[model samples]
Target: MRGVFLLLGLVGLCNASVLTVNDEIHMRSKRSSESEMTRIRNMSPSDRPNCQPGVTPPKIQVDTTERLSDLRNRFTAAGIHGYLVPSEDAHQSEYPSNYDLRREFISGMSGSAGRAVVLQNKAALWADGRYFLQAEDELDCHWILMKLGEEGVPTVTEWIEANLMDGQSFGVNTYLIKNVEWDEMSKDLAKKGITLKGVTPDLIDQIWTSGRPDQPNSPINALPLKYSGKSWQDKINNMHVAMAEKEADIMIVTGLDETAWLFNLRASDIDYNPFFLSYAIVNRAANTTILYIKSATSKLTASPTDAATTETVQQHLNTGASGSCSGRTGMCVTVKEYSNQQLQNDISSAVSTTTGYVWVSFGCSRAVYSSITAERVIQDNTPIALQKAQKNTVEQQGMRNSHIRDAVALIKFMAKLEKEVKEGKHWTEVKAAADLKKHRMAVKDNRGLSFSTIAGSGSNGAVIHYFPTNDTDKDITTSDMLLLDSGGQYLDGTTDVTRTFHFGTPTAYEKECYTRVLMGHVDFADVVIVGGTFGREIDSIARRPLWDVGLQYRHGTGHGIGMYLSVHEGPGRISLSHSSFISDEPLNEFQFFSDEPGYYEDGQFGIRLENIVMVKKATTKYQFPGTTFLTFETVTMVPYEPHLIVKELLSQQEVNWINAYHKTVQDTIGPLLADDALAASWLSARTKHMTLENETGSGNQQTAFLSLVAFAFVTHFIL
Candidate 1:
């Protein structure tokens, strides 16, 4: 078997014109024993992240005096009238490393989504509705807040054009901006005879020279074939086919997740994201592969010590060659230092030798796109993204299993929380969040959190992307609505689930809003679509219930979810806005997305129900030629809060759907909670069947009886 795989791997590299997929790579996962499960359940939480008080970033005001003066000096030296600062790294990552947080460092706006532009005299920040309140609180009086999506508010480009003169030049770090964004801005500015120059060294880095954090140099580890479900050799062969179809001689993988997925690797360079800062270049005709990283000589081990070494990673990649690809055996790789100079030199050599074009994603850095000849560059979405979005059979199963484990932890936390709140125990939002994290860390195969947990109480829940801090933490009381949006990154898959709870009685308005949101979520999950339907066309299905009441949320309805990778993947999303480039892509089978429909009242409370669902083929009575029907199969098994539901508002069909969904949750997660008596009782009560006639009754009246049954079972085991 080893020899057969070796031959197929060699064919992938040695003969790119006739590359073949290496299907001989074995993919399997080890099942956990009952003893292991019990041991993991009793594990300590002291070693986890959220269990302890987290360090907070200092409230350092954005110094317009020293920082702006220093940046303006650089602009003068670079011969530009203004400079643009984006909140993204060279990889266009959503959560960039501290070293690449130039926008936050310069503007003091730490929100993830925003753009900063600074001229000699004036500066401004552009942010969406989610961060309007946050941006106002963070940015100093020196900066103008340009609220995005508001009527009559100019866009970043329009604002730039309005500020600059015809003969002036505006500058940006080409290595930090997306290629498509750069193209659009350049063309728009050029019409007014304004120059948009590509600055080599970023101005913010120059200003932040004194106390800037160092770049990440974490360990780069291999993801086992059991978890990845595909060998890197097979993935590269698929890439070769994609390149051949595009008639490109070289393909550049710039996105961090793209590189990690292509190579079957994982790292912790970015917070909450299992990814490293890296780039890859594959020359098909030359049969050469090069991985660029900060420390090429560093040891490569399987994360958390799974017995993989540098040599194993090399073997898995079939990487072994001294210099040239003249007589390379398999997919030989050359590890090189990560720098723009080296990347440019290698791209020049590849373009000089081949007559074919160079394949690069439009999501790639503008600097990378500019390195190749304009006509020879094929700019589009990377094929790896589409491939990664569509999970394999192994990955799909892993997602299901991970969500079950996640549900066990969440149920335990909710049970304990409801008990404590009823007993008048004091709990802060931060403490409750930590308790949830502690429970999650005790689950088997758990790695870490997928993102920071959003634990908002009362009015804080109204803030869509709210994160509680020490200064802003509020007590989570029974009278308030608690919105918890959180996720975990397990070894097998990623899990993101959100549920709003009301320990006390909710008002009629609150119940109505929650039920409306629930209705939207159910509608979205139940809708069947044609094969080639775009997410934008059907996004209204999730918002119709809210729209009928003239209430809406500012954010998108759903986003693509990654498998043990980035929580936010790309190429497909469920959003109504046309501003997003990925919203138009067709949804495909095996693709996972968050079916989250929400409604937020600015001062009172917020209601959102989120479930990570997989797109699957739907059974239809009739089949159309050249088309397929699709529907959602929800993988998140956590039940909704019965206290906040208004049964009177639910239709018969909706009531039946909710009942069926709760039954599925109990059937799936009940066995896993056999040992945790408290969690088992909670799950049973939460999943109790509901009917329209039971509008005013408490659905969990049987909780006391279930708890007694669980206690008897535990006592029998003790005897």
Candidate 2:
């Protein structure tokens, strides 16, 4: 998942000079204002550089004293005892722009997920297991690190209740709080006699006056019909059908990805995610659609590169020859400035026109929820999420095509890296990640990285979402376990894959752990589920193998992926979590998601194997009435590390599955790598037939040869 960061300048010590500290500060500020400040305000239509994952931003220092003091002053002025800073933007987006990173700025923790509370006397940051080590490395002593899900660590609400005094007000930005979150917290705090106030103009915003980046205002373009598979008009018609079924007169679309998908639009407002900041309103009774966006038509027309895109969108919406949708002859989308005032007025008007119910997702912001009458608003998961999760015919084909190309790039990188490490040529994790991206970019239809590359080596692999930064980079060695989790965004589709590799011989314990993880992955992929079964019902299949040995990983087994859209999609997931709305969605055909299971030993090594699998109809021996069977089609064509597997531990069924999958990999991706001999050889070596035989067999001999190669390299380095 993508996170947020602030673009503040790096604070460095100044040597002996004629300039005073104040003078130096003034000069640096002037320079920043002249260049960086101007660029932020006047952004071009082109996409900004992709974010560097794992690498700390310039502002990630071990000190937050000055910033905390400023925020405390604001809390005092607002007459609130404490303030809560969440990790979402006004749109409830998971991957917010750099401008909306108040939580990171005040707490000094940059992981994608976390919550922070600041009182005049004490401050604490709550992070989950994935970020515990990262939080320890980044946060200073001024803040207490509360590891979430730990036995003694309390949740954010529980912590607030324990810390705050009775009748004291705790402030939060209502625009950033989801309706469900606000409702639950308000009720919970009211029982404790604590006032949960909805504060305007966030307290952090008041204090972060300088050095904060400007809000994103990128160009909007239409996704081609070939890529989208369905027209925007057809998608809206489907929405109308769902709306009619729900008895909804008006529907509010607040999720950024939902809006982008609804209009067949794409933008670079947020990195990695091809989404723009906008709101949509759909009226089934009135046959009206409205899109609220910043500088709506002006920004689209300003860029010559977007001329065709603007025309396509205008025609697709039926705006007519006038190039606008004001009092048009046919039904069309009306574009308006994206502002809170304008949106609230429109919502009020829509609600006023409808005696029927207004539909909105429970994830909608409290600010939007407050404008509607309580009796008329119906809150549930948005219908568009389910519709998007199931891909159409064209999208399914594109996913397969793009993944083949993606495999070509990944296999090339793996082969080259393995060869280098065997020859004793050192490569840093950052450099290796860059080389992988170079290969991905050379492929056709590549847009950019789906997310920051997770290229962790040795001890770094224990960090689940480890990103290699200049400060934490490690050299690739034969003795280290390297975990590479990365993805690419193509014009056709989106992909996410994780593969763990060891260039040298592994201990028996390591081999056993890897085999168990592989067993889970194979089992989850091969199981046939009954129709209407929820994801949680089947999630344990991926973890049962590990659980048998009293070992389990901390993260979810899988999450939904979009086609050239958000990588971490929702309303469908495979996890043990009982609280999330997405966890309850039933397994359906045409749905694509990941199947990843792993085991990690803290400060030693980590092992995870992942592939994107598609849900499809399964042929069963017997069919019961009103019951349908479904299985998965693994689209990712990369081969697993052959040497890491303990073949004797696998059942014949599991062994057959591995052999079949490797054969498919060679058959599908083998021809594409014909031009690259080294990569072809590497693929052939790894994908060879596996058997539960003795160690002196042909497959084991090949493994021994590779080990000898690594040993020679290590011995040469020693000399």
Candidate 3:
């Protein structure tokens, strides 16, 4: 629900930047490294997921002509005229597994985001500006590369309108399309006499039976109440309260995070994310909550069902008891262990059995709705998201506690890198990432990394999401800037922190850039939002300093972060840009976000400073009566690298902010480490404030006494 970019909204019209160009367009690329694979292999067998979602597989050379020919056969067999393959899994995830790379499997374009439209006669693929260069490099001659967000380059819908004839049949897998999206597209297409067909048992799957990766059925781990901060029963109660307010009889939750949060469970089914695939349906009035998880989940714990009355899938399929929801006691917690198509069939039966109104969240797909026998479908965006986004006191404290451990791990890794580099020892990006991840996992209740460690060095740092492979990995050198943007998945909370450092003495320009970026980050972090300040309204504070210097970052200044859930969890964000995900709302208390602002000089270096902070009610002296004020509570306890910062550029106020934040980091993380350890020394040295020439006298002070006297004297003499 959070990660997937816009599918095909092609509006910001401009002259097209054709992909087939002589000049190489600078872009970000994600690569899986050798050390990472070794780490994966070294992990315990139980920890190994069937498919590593984060691992960037080698460039797949898909024969477009051959694949198109095969697809056309299926299209002919199914009597389908056209099909749309998006980079979407059944859950509509941002990064689907290799098993679900249907778009890449057919199109031969391997950008993280893109869509392919295939017709019997012609086929085309579309990518936004981010992948224009990549598309040119990866796309074969068989597919027409359409540059999205360009002038005269129509959106998928626009292309369909301009090209396709009336009375044509267009098909898509219903599971990959949300009900809302399908309804909108169907209505829009129907106007032109186009029939939108809902295809089941994916057409791609039909063609891709040869070497599809195994579906994940990883064992489920129960998230203890200490980590979760609430029992599943209590969470259910909260959902029921929202359901009552919505006046919906039944609520369907499909988002992975939503499901994971609803039912206190975690797994390694998806890479980086500790989540298991599942569906949750809760009835407000009936007080029944049905959790349909994999068979592997059943093996994780004893069947939470009465063995005497428990009906297996075989029994359900044989008889018409397809909707059996077996419970542990006389409670409403029904755990239906299933595999393969059982989840779909069981969900269909479960929702259809209800004669009352069915509430589907934003994440619910058209496939789920197609089989429903409910009287009505209510557009009920899951309230559990906002509920979970605003962490409770326990979760807040957990986050603070978790970051302390994470800070220690990071300090050790960074210190190790500094020592190695200073001693003229060679270190690679892969080694750096592996070493950091290793330290992270050694902490208490550490699952693994929150995401792939973004350990970029020198020119590599310029690539915002640059993940190193053996081929592209850079060696750590004194003359390069290392941007270590990494996080940990601790049981207490999730951690995301970025600190850019230069191993060698930085140039004047580099110091200025780093300080300016740091200034922007602190400015945004220190903002006290008064009277319903939406995140978008206050986004400029992070960019003003960068803008003043004619520099800007491509990505958003800040994004919402989840506690022990998704690193980029949403429903709210601190961004000026509007998308399908960013909803306009007041910045609420306990909501966390990574306050990061950066500058990137292509083929040179990138600098970004990020710290996760929780929103809290601001106790301001001056505020409009009857209005609320909000501020941020620093949660990420890591220290900033002082070497790269030009302290002379910082104002007294900025210097104070750094000193205060460093003190907090020291106070929180200092005790967590051993007394005689290298980490403690490193932390102390890293956080130690740089002494400016003067607190009262500094650069660019126009309102100085001399200036004021000169102005006054000049005016008096003139008079």
TM-score for each predicted model, relative to the true structure? 0.85, 0.87, 0.81
Poorest stretch of ten by lDDT in candidate 3:
13-22
Q: What tens digits encode model 2's per-residue C-alpha lDDT throughout 241-275?
A: 99888889899999898998888888888888888
Tens digits of lDDT, candidate 1, 253-367:
8889898899887888888788888888988888778888776644332233444333444445554432233455766667677787898888888888888878887577889
C-alpha lDDT values of all predictions? 0.74, 0.76, 0.68
Model 1 ranges off by over 4 Å: 1-65, 300-311, 320-328, 580-584, 693-719
| TM-score, model 2 to reference | 0.87
Superposition error at 582 for model 3 (Å): 5.9
Tell me how many residue pairs clash in candidate 1: 0
Worst 10 residues of 2 by lDDT: 1-10
Could you tell me how far off, in angstroms, the CA of residue 612 lies in candidate 2 after the best superposition? 0.5
Would you give me the overall lDDT of model 2?
A: 0.76
Give the winner by lDDT.
2
